[model samples]
Target: MMKKRTILRFFILATLLLCSSSAWAQGHSYLKTAAGKSLQAELEFHRDPHQTFAVRGDNLVLAGDLPVNVNYDFDYSVLEGQTLTVDGEQQHGGRNLVSIVTSPGEVRVESGTMTINKVTKEGEKAFLEGTYELTLEEGKTLSGEFKLHTQFRDYNLSSLGWVFMLASIAGVWLLAIFCYKKLLFDAE
Candidate 1:
């Protein structure tokens, strides 16, 4: 009885831990100082699960595996300030990911920004939730949260995705065994 309960608890915990993994999102801060000097920075941001994620005081190297037509540049290299202040609290989160095409492809963005309003915390990790304002190079802008069943053509299979998939299978298997025992053998 106790053993079965322990196993059940383990399965539940594992599911939660695996499914709530974080996704990385970033942007840029283009600003002009009080003296009208221009400066720029590529911002790699992480909200919850870590309000203290470090933004280095040194030179930041910004690079990505983004599409060809899409590219990032800082108007002027070297962030003017040694530090940047970031503070925002969002109470809602959890991303609903779906398959855009099933076989996997790519998501292309021309321009604009992606703002994650709320970040979900699962165990020691975090999950994605927010809206993207994308402007393709041809003078078009798209604004919306990534909706359910909307798959990225080239979806990056993150570790969190694997963990969540495996954990779900394990949870289902465990639950079936547990139910079978409770019904047939009366293990309670």
Candidate 2:
């Protein structure tokens, strides 16, 4: 009776371990864009399990094993002479990788060829262009747009222009009430 109980316990423990390992191996990797978009991809492990992996864009998440010596690139597009800010963050062990952001002027890559150009103000208008590259296992590229903006011949403003105009009218009304109470009315 004692021998049988020992054997049963051993078998149950072995099965649990196998199942756990299998589940961990099947986990997926994820990438998120700056515009609140997300994409997931499966990771393929080679030799080392805790190697460095690279991810680009915002809120990048990785599961399972990491990759070795990974490189990631990010690019952006904006109207010429426009001041833009770029940023990124990594989840899990993703910080071990190196990330680079290249704008249109700093380094220009076309048709797999790299060229350095003096990014300058082109007349009174310019078109923005950039790219992002990730060195990792083969997978699909996910993309999405951030906030929308209209480009005019001279200036650009947020898409909420109408909202701003309405707010201005409300402000004027409030100011008028304040002025009337202060100059023409008595406190009760």
Candidate 3:
């Protein structure tokens, strides 16, 4: 009886471990450079509620570190299948922006289309598959596919709201300590 129970426990533990590993797996993404070199990276979509005055709506941001010390940021409107131009000249604050920074040089997107193939929702998170074909400033083409995981965020608190909440908690804590001290003094 004891041996059977131990075997059952080990089987259950191994099954749980296998299931958890699959749940935490990251999606795959890659971009081929102008020189025919492919850069692989994991990209995830995060809904950013904080946008500047110029930007119209919330942006679906894809920012991640690439191979060979490269970092890329791609921001697009939440709506799928909407084609927009990549602003290479302007580095920051624009709709449908694509910027890539490398160790030695920076590669900006001159023109191209980023197509969203499909989006699959699993519970609160979603998986996005897309492809991008970009013409670089160096007159080279960069294209690849991306499978990104979605990150859900709550908009209940802004930056100011967070600060105010902390301040209120501190104030209440201080008030409680002060009252406790006064009560002790009066009793003495």
Candidate 4:
């Protein structure tokens, strides 16, 4: 019975860990435009995960929806210097779609860790510093290398829910103890 209960407790804990909403969170992306413009988009809307702007790979699909409602999807690659096909359409001809130059290292953005890559200057390549505060074209200031995001990557758990979960565990343990005593020792 002890072994059974230990297994049961493990299962219950696993279930709670898996089904919890705080495990996953909404991510956001911050970008600076060529015109020195500042743009922010939600990962939920931009279709990125863990606030990952984009991964460097072949035929990578990248989209930046900003300025309200102008949806643009493009196929791009970071490892290879290829023309970024805008709108994912072959006919448009990706000549000057978007360019980026990233340094070799990891940068902390907001509460989560994000890759601080440069949104390359037209006709020229530029380097991005991870510890610098960036100002946008619209006069919006990004706080340190974190110009990309402004939040931490911690669990979004509610204090009330956490308390309730703890209480439930204690209650279950107490009930189990009472049941064990009544059945094993109090059986007269």
Per-candidate TM equals 0.24, 0.21, 0.47, 0.25
What's the true lDDT of residue 66 in model 1?
A: 16
| Candidate 1, poorest ten consecutive residues by summed lDDT | 68-77
Query: What's the CA error at residue 81 for candidate 4, in Å?
Result: 33
Residues 26-138, model 2: lDDT tens digits? 22223334455434323221223343222222333222222123221111122223322222222334333223323212221111111112122334322222232332223
Model 3: residues >4 Å from true position, as ranges? 1-24, 27-78, 89-98, 101-106, 157-186
Q: In model 4, what are the clashing residue pairs, if there are any?
A: 36-137, 111-151, 111-152, 111-153
Please give the lDDT score for candidate 4: 0.34
- Runs of candidate 1 exceeding 4 Å displacement: 1-108, 147-188
Cα-lDDT of candidate 1: 0.34
lDDT of 1 by residue, 1-84 (tens): 999999999999988766653112212232222344322332333222322222111221111111111111211112212122
How many residue pairs in model 1 have overlapping backbones?
8
Residue-level lDDT for 133 in candidate 1: 44
Residue 178 lDDT (model 1) = 96
Best by TM-score: 3
Identify the runs in model 2 with alpha carbons over 4 angstroms from their true place: 28-188
Candidate 4 residue lDDT tens string, 75-138? 1113122211112111112221232222212221222123334333212222222332333223
- In angstroms, the error of model 1 at 64 is 6.9
State which candidate has the highest lDDT: 3
In order, what lDDT does every prediction score?
A: 0.34, 0.34, 0.49, 0.34
